[model samples]
Target: MSNTFPPVDGTWRNHYLLMRHGHSQANQEGRIISSPALGLTGFGLSPRGCTQLDTLLADWRWARPQRILHSDFLRTAETAERVAAHFDLTLTLEPRLRERHFGEFEGQSDDRYAEVWARDAKDPTHRQGGVEAVSEVAARMRAVIDELERHYHDETILLVSHGDPLQILLTALEGRELSLHREREPLAPASITSL
Candidate 1:
């Protein structure tokens, strides 16, 4: 009675479980701030976020995760903590799993950020303002996944991370480009996508 997300071509052999963080303060306020920038050591989850884990655990749909890797962000860590406790698994933090370095856009609202975001995509190597390109994030995540493929072929690994990077990685895995990311559907908070 397990659920299966058919791969791109309806093939099923390798399994990669990707999950977005649960609700967070920034998430509640609809902001793009990162935990490190704000000095929130644990990626503080909001009350709704805390309840997300409770709901997830109560549901039987969540697969018992084996190896756990998550972003160091407070939101991600908070979500991982709940999952780890429920499964008694150790959570691994990879800085590479952190959210896209928003650079100049770190604390800005959507309207304020959209202008630069448009230009940023044109040349993904834009790091002058401490910003990281979507390409670099994809490369890093791909590096991690490639290594994981070598070490855990045909095995399941859960990577709990932020929206942008996950979207980037998924695009690369499918041999697509980042522009397609915006066209991609939004991943729900605490939702899981199998690839």
Candidate 2:
């Protein structure tokens, strides 16, 4: 298929479809599960999440993904599996696309994310509450995009990941400050944003 998406002015050689994984067990329980310890084995997609993906795929309107890369976390893994299987495409695990490590905030109330953003707004490199630095998340997310751009030109690739990391990536892609990540629109569960 011809690439209808416009190329970046001086970079980004591939079309990108960034998608947040479906609602997870953590989302259902209103908890923040951002660490590998909890995310790897637990907080997978909920029943509603499955339904959401089924419905989304049934009436999909966006560019079809020729390749799928996703976080290894159970939630994103499940999401990518469904998408890849539906499209008969190979699924690749990209660990750098994992959720922002919440550190001390793992398994806590989701509301605690506000505090993390507050600190992030002041200093993107701050690791208060042992949280992963916003700058670090941005760097990894950017690296994934750069690598994908270099490897896959003139194709639509889907990246399944978490909300926070996706937001930081989007902000960075827009040439904005990492500290302003929260200022970008929030990525709803299973929502897709293109670049």
Tell me, by TM-score, which candidate is best.
Answer: 2
Clashes within 3 Å, all models in order? 3, 0
**Steric clash pairs (candidate 2):** none
lDDT of prediction 1: 0.73
Could you give candidate 2's per-residue lDDT for residues 1-195 as a string of tens digits? Answer: 111224335756777888999988999999999889989989899998999899889988788999899999999999999999899999999999999999898889999999999999999999988999999998898888888777777898999999999989878777788899999768888888877
Q: Which ranges of candidate 2 are over 4 A from the true structure?
A: 1-11
**Backbone-clash count (model 2):** 0
What is the TM-score of candidate 2?
A: 0.94
lDDT of 1 by residue, 45-125 (tens): 889978876887788475567888988888888888888888889989877888887777676664554654575557655
Error of 2 at 69 (Å): 0.4
